[model samples]
Target: MSFIRLATPLRSAVPRTAYRRLSTQTTPEKKSNNTALYFLGAGIAGISGYIYLTGSATAKVKATNTESPLDPKSFKDFKLKEIIPYNHNTARFVFELPNNEAALLPVASCLVVRSPEDLPEDDPRALKDSKGKPVIRPYTPVSQPDEPGVLTLLVKKYDNGVASKYIHELKVGDKLAFKGPLPKYLYKANEFEEVALIGGGSGITPLYQILTHALPDPANKTKFTLIFANLTEEDILLREEFDDLKKKYSDKFDVVYALDKPKEDWKGETGHLTGEVLKKYLAKPELGEKVKVFICGPPGQVNAIAGKKDGYQQGPLGGILKELGYKEDQVYKF
Candidate 1:
């Protein structure tokens, strides 16, 4: 297997001196002029600082205009109050929004939960559905961390999927306790000029968070390209929201749908995500050199795109990426 090195974090540059003494043997007049120049420089620095502060405050207000009142820090103590089904197999769990002063969560973070024991084996909130079937699973939140009163988790049902089945059976007014504000993968805004998101099945949850967070900020200047693959066109979730984001942020966001089994009239890309196909939609290897890749999905799909071999290994993504000469550190798996 080929090995790739992770990139080290970029270091901040040292500040440069504003002024330097010219010839220590300068005359008295020259010394006086130098002192005057120093004060002038100080004045300019003060003005610049004030302008920066004012602009920063204005920007914060604009960004926080629709911000959530629920604090993320207090997410650990929040309780689940409702579960709304999104499909036959998927549901959105709603938590009783926290009321703490510092409960706001950072964008791209997730809430963690430890399921309770001692509930009836057949209980809907337990690890089983109404039919006493086993169910229950872990998932990331789809809603913004700051939103007040309600946190939604989009869960897809699978055959013998314990978590999903239990969630589907939950009714309004029921309490399902959970702990979180648990950290998840986050891409710092403007850290890179471009980003590529590769997702399969429900892996799109985190990708959606990143895309939505990036699309609204004009200052971010980070472009995004998404490669979403699923079993079939009907299996693709969040179709409406993805469409809206594409339309609203047309200049900065691009999405390509790849279905394993597409209908006759389907016009978009199709088939499994192969090296050749990824190369076609992605920027060249050189462009990928500076780009960060986020991969999430079934272990096989994630492993394939991330360049893993012999099941899931610790090494860097292997296949086409290594062949294309992309660096290992550029890829992050979730």
Candidate 2:
């Protein structure tokens, strides 16, 4: 296999906000005093019943006119006004945002979409929040940052996946409320010399954005290698796009597909992506020194490759990569 290297650095059209660190200091005395003051204020307010009624009415009106405060970056609501299928189980949803603004959803950021009506009371995914309203799960965006007005999410169906099923059943003109640009795993362009993408099934969605953005930009110095593990040849998503990228940007991209089962004519790598296979495809440990690795898949594959007991912990890439002395900072799990 040939290794591809970038010819130029990739530049992001949108300016990135500066990273801020949070202060960790705390005081129990201040906490206790604030709690006491809050309760005392509440008790006084309760005695004036009309004050509470007026305040509630004002709050309701404000909520009705304003956007959801839950959005961290103060983004307006975007509606799913259209849907297009990429395959039998996956789809690309087109979201229509306010003012026909360019849909610039960053890679790894997800949108929390919900039906106009509340989910059925008995639905397992449906649960009452503190205010007794049902909450919905979040889904990541698969569309590019520059794609205008239409943000796409490539969703795969599962037998018990409530959100996926609901989204798939929708027609072109259906309206679904969504709020986001919620933060998730992200890698700033040109931050690392080399990047490795390890993905399985629908886990490829996030990596797709990363690869597309990284490869096309001349200002981005990052080089990428993808080790995509799937059940079969037919299970591989975005195969044509990857092939075209490999051919066009031969010096900046490399891809290896691992299938769980191989047919008679199968010629590419086969079987699960074990430690041995990782070692064969990954750059040497010396090269890994400047490389940032991203792994995403089913919990089992992610855990096995991530080599962590708890799902949240970050560590060296599992299997042979760990055995080869890769450090914790060199690998990331998604």
Candidate 3:
């Protein structure tokens, strides 16, 4: 609701500076073996996480529902209500919902977006081909369903990405086709005595959803630890909010950062997500279902921790978890 609502697409979004390979075919969406989104970062004032939706105990009960927001096969049109630029590559896209219905979602779910091929084309993006067939991009909702009138997505822009490119090109008042709050994971109150979320980049969105949802539930006593990995200190997302969570709920929540590059002042772990970090931060696997591990992020991290993807199915739990004696059911990929 605090975002900028424009009547037309901003010319700034169009690439005025010439770049190579503008006409190359858009790549298909990769099937992630990565666990449903779960990651963390640190920040202080005005964190970008607020650009999505930061939760509180008071706003908790409003966004609960288990139905699909829209039919996946049949697209429902939603209007672009606002656009909030979070950083260089990420933006908070706000869309108006059709009505006052339940937000049609469960914990850790996503919807697909498609561009209309019927629009006047000044420059063709990857969303549709000449034949008008649309490519779908699945994105998890960052806004709580209780946030009235609008659904929010924290989008990370990509140069050759069909859906991201199409979404980036959209202006105010543009209608986008969306469908499904396809449930990825059904989380219950204190299903696990402890949950460890491992993620990086945008993968943290789903983890954020689960964290916010759990903290509000009086029945959920699940302690949480977040291990977020990124290239540099600046790359860490939602740092301040995570810090605030840890500060306020220090008894229940903990966060760890593993940056590939760190400054002199850096205090947390610095390296790839390896077994040592897992052993130090993650709850011991001996607890079984009382402790569950969730991972999401780069294919390398996912592949390393949970093995690769055979299409959408996880290949094997063959990395740090396996070395540490964690079983398949004990871990899940997003």
Candidate 4:
């Protein structure tokens, strides 16, 4: 049989569970005192009472916090509520929010996440990069912006990934500090006649966020096409959700998938995304600013499609998109 060596596993586009241990050391008097304090605080709040069972387990936000729990300026610690294994190296992490409120993030934004500050310096869970600076990563949330009580992230594990490994080992109720709905491209309904989202592996989250927010709105008249690439059939993330979108909004949405290796029965496009595939699938430059192409993936894929991002700058547009007659203004690199 002919064989194709696997490509380097896609670096998660900068993107787990365990059980928390309970202590049995509390004396009855301490417990009574804690319980009294909890109820006293709840009574003080009246209708908007605090209902968290474990004191100090959840992030502290203002008691009058409203609309969203995320603060762009400051880090807040949120407890892990659940973990669901999605594939061999991917999972969905659900984090608890204060008082059962929605994350309320704006469309096409992300959260900056890092290990809790309290971890000891030598602890394995404390993640640091090469310079020993605390490692922080941006993740696009998988749940809807208005999804209440929790925020969800779809994360793919990379072998040398410090953040992924730290997250995978966490037990339920463990905390991670998070900040921001750091804005990406501000997407608005009907602004574009057609939008093309090209993503690979874990990069799908941001594209998914844009679609979920836009497609269901009664005011939406925009059309969307997603060209998602992956290593194998099983590597396709959010397949079910995309399929449902195709069904419900048949006129407004469609998806094309490219796989590096394919099963005998596979029917989608084969091989990595290329100028040819993009030429076939992406909206034409002739459509002007009314058409937007968004690309997000591993560095290799993003660089190939739209050129490397220069630090925080979008950098100069080059590569397949530029070669195919798309302008820098017509594309957004995520």
Q: Write one digit per residue (lDDT tens) for candidate 3, span 163-270.
A: 777788889888787778777788888788889999888888888888878876666688999999988887777777789889978878999998888998989899
User: Best by TM-score, which number?
Assistant: 4
Q: Write the per-residue lDDT of candidate 1 for residues 251-275, one digit (tens) a residue.
A: 8888999999999999888898888
- Per-prediction count of colliding residue pairs? 13, 7, 12, 1
Write down the lDDT that model 3 would get: 0.74
lDDT ranking, high to low: 4, 3, 2, 1
**What is the lDDT, from 0 to 100, of the residue 98 in candidate 3?**
58
Q: What's each prediction's TM-score?
A: 0.68, 0.69, 0.75, 0.79
Query: In model 3, what lDDT does residue 85 have?
Result: 87
Worst 10 residues of 4 by lDDT: 13-22
Model 4 lDDT, full chain set:
0.84
Q: Encode model 4's per-residue lDDT on 191-296: one tens digit a residue.
A: 9899999999899999999999999998899999999999999999999999999999999999998999999999999998889888887779999989999999
Cα lDDT computed for each candidate against the true fold: 0.67, 0.68, 0.74, 0.84
Q: By lDDT, who's the top model here?
A: 4
For every candidate, C-alpha RMSD to the true structure in Å: 18.8, 23.8, 20.3, 17.2
Give the poorly placed runs of model 3, Cα more than 4 Å off.
1-69, 100-102, 117-126, 129-133
